[model samples]
Target: MFPLERQQKIMDLLKLKKVLKISELTEELNISVDTLRRDLNTLTKQEKIEKIYGGVKLVESKFAESSMDERMVSHLEEKERIALKCTEFIQDGDCIYLDSGSTTYQIAKYIKHFKNLTVVTNSIPVVNELMNSSVELVIIGGKIRLNEQSVVAYDYIFNFDQLNILKAFLCASGITVEKGISDYNLEEAITRKKIIDMSKEIYVAADSTKFGKDVTVSIASLDKIDVLVTDANLNKNMIQKFRKTNTKLIIAEGP
Candidate 1:
């Protein structure tokens, strides 16, 4: 792998494992010990990571602790662009599922432009956005997460088998070619898993920043997604990496 790509792989590994020994990094990256040390030194100088006695750990990131409102505005332009591109997949009279996320909430803003659409979602913000729109809205009911502004239908009583979700637009905290898609919350992951199983086409809407990252809960493998919608801000290297996978990627152009 190229130096930049190798460094990114190191970062990705560190995100998933939190900390790693130098030997582990060398083995995982298939690089020499000297090369691994060089990469670690670079990351240290960039203030993105810290080297321990024999291992390295990522620096604390503000993005990890951000609230729903903060996340909503974190990458506003890119999220908006991604959201608009996702709407192009929807057609009149389609039963679509919108997974709870800041990016998907932007999709709700364009709900009025469609005709005879049945919108199913777990996002409170999406529900509010479509409250007065002409499209029919169905909400997945369960415990509501105040910080995420999302509802998790974890109880067995809530049946997702009945819903014929034509297209599912999902969001993820982290997505990678090897690890697939993941989220920080388990309950929300459970809810998304159910919806994904029923949907004909799974469309994951995530900003470019989400790439090369992994979180706690595994939602599904990358192959399960029919298409991944991301903004043009995504690096070319990541795009090339994803192209090697089976999942189709759609890059939304910016203004």
Candidate 2:
């Protein structure tokens, strides 16, 4: 088999079995030990898998997420700075979509004063925060995912294509040059993909820590987003890497 084909086969097998010994992988693929090592190194560099002492495991399955309350406090200062920077993109009358996330939730506290602005979301926390705010609020009603505190429509009651979404501020579990954007939940990623397609512009609000990671469900690639707003704590190496991509980068500075 070709190198790319063999590598893909390795990933497929790992996804199914979760982890396997190096000897097991070599036997399954009918490849030499040196070739297997080369493939494993490539996957590791892509942040798709990790090498244990004698075995390898899929990275996506190992990534754990905390509850909404825990995440809110985990990156409090960085999230706040990102939230403040996102507000600059909002105009007086633009309609926007805020994807459910702790970082995106911080935006709710700052956007109350904009006139004729409409905020559409699936997040319960966002709705409650802007309940009495002057800006028009629209909720995407569906089955509630309590842990994330967000609603997801499995039946398409709300046609996002019909809505004139000027901008969409989204969050994701992981973002990478090769994988683009991804999430842990398949349902959530599906909903975000719909919003991304319908909106005029896409703005992904992720902290520096979220970079270089890849999750199970694919959202959109780097080219799909108009801008990526991240904190300045992101290293110069990563920033330089993104500079080579088509996506525009915005680094939020600390006050």
Candidate 3:
């Protein structure tokens, strides 16, 4: 099999078994030890798997709940590209909601040029990024999540209902055709649901790595999303699958 095919098979096996011994992988793929090692190295470099003493394991749940700092560093360039693309949907005087996530924080960074904009968010990092800017900021009130640097309060849904958001840029822990959009935290999921309900247009900001995975809670269906802004690294097969669902997929060019 080709290298990409072999790597994909390795990821498929890791998804099923979580962790696989190198010897077992060699047996399963019918490849030599050296070939298996190279495959493991490639997967590890891609951050799709973690190398252990004798084998490799899928970077799963723990990655979903990773700290904001951890996430900020993982896909910095992709997040920046997606953030820049998100700006295209924002008008000068638009009232928008920025969901709490590293990618959304990047959006906040890029929006500093918007002279007249009302920004609503629960993300502390986002607030910090836009605080010194000309944008009008409305912070959501809720119990603080220290690691994520965001807020989560179900009562805030009532506040969301009071406002009309022109557009909303949201992030997800994982997104799949079957499960739609999902995240690891229940409270954040509830908040995102409300944001979707209030917004006129919804744009999901996620990297290609987030595709084909499902996390703890569902936020919305694929149909609910107006656009999906992701990095250009997404495969053609995945893009075709997303197109079949009628979700407008925008692959942001990387810097």
Candidate 4:
């Protein structure tokens, strides 16, 4: 197979089942260990996969550690759908906290012209998105974490803890019943949990792919979420499981 195709296959396998050993790749992909090694090397260079002792693992770091540009490509159509779904929970004259994520940022796009709305966010890009709007904007001030492209240390914790929030949109690395809402960064998780705790209603903005994934830290339990807006591609059983919770699940693609 072509190199790009092979790399894509490797990523797919890793994403589907986390880490993959060399022998496993050989058995499944019908390729030699050497070819697999080359594939791993190539993907590693591309920052898609990280090479482990005897296998390869998908890159799990959301911020790539300490890089300044914490940019990523999300499932765009799904994010837009979720954004639309979010509007259902929002009423006029509501004060909301928007967490930093590609999906949450999508929500910002939909809220630009919204009246009687207040937005408090840590993302610089998010602030830029809503700055021109008539909606009241409150930019959380803190130590700017370039990697996540957010403010997490000071402004979000001390400054925001004083305010009463009506609603919050939380983005997660994984939204599992087992682990609750988890994120790659500790500070980010803390910020999200704090926001949820402060808000009268908490809504999780995530894509279906985020379900069942695992992260290092837990922000809050599934019971803490009042609403979840996600893509329609979530597994039916899993979606039903989430539906059984106190949280209301809203599919973005609609009926």
Candidate number with greatest TM-score: 3
C-alpha lDDT score of every prediction, in listed order? 0.87, 0.88, 0.86, 0.78
In candidate 2, residue 224 scores what lDDT? 97
CA shift at 191, candidate 1, in angstroms?
A: 0.7
Runs in model 2 lying further than 4 Å from the true structure: 1-62
Candidate 2's residue-wise lDDT over 1-255, tens digit each?
988998899999977777678899999999999999999999999998877547777763356764675566556788889999999999999999999998999999999999999999999999999999898999987889998999996655776666899999999889999889999898899889989988999999998989998988999999999999999999899999999999999999998
> Candidate order by TM-score, highest to lowest?
3, 1, 2, 4
Instruction: Report the C-alpha lDDT of model 3 over 34-153, residue by residue, as the tens digit.
Output: 988898889888999976546777775544576675567566788889999999989899999999998988998878888689999999998888888999999888889997899986
What clash pairs does model 3 have?
A: none
C-alpha lDDT (0 to 100) for residue 128 of candidate 2: 95
lDDT of 4 by residue, 17-121 (tens): 776778889888888888888888888888987665566677757543312222233355777888888877788888988888878888888886677898888
Top model by lDDT, which number?
Answer: 2
TM-scores of all predicted structures: 0.76, 0.75, 0.76, 0.72
Ten-residue region with minimum lDDT total, candidate 4: 65-74
lDDT for model 1: 0.87
Pick out the ten consecutive residues of candidate 1 with the lowest summed lDDT.
62-71
Model 1: runs farther than 4 Å from truth? 1-65
Candidate 1 per-residue lDDT, tens place, 1-255, comes to 888898899999977767677889988888899898888889899998876556777775734633575566556788999999999999999999998888999999876779899999999999899999898999988998998999999557578878999999999999999989999888989999988898999999999988998988899999899999999989999999999988999999988
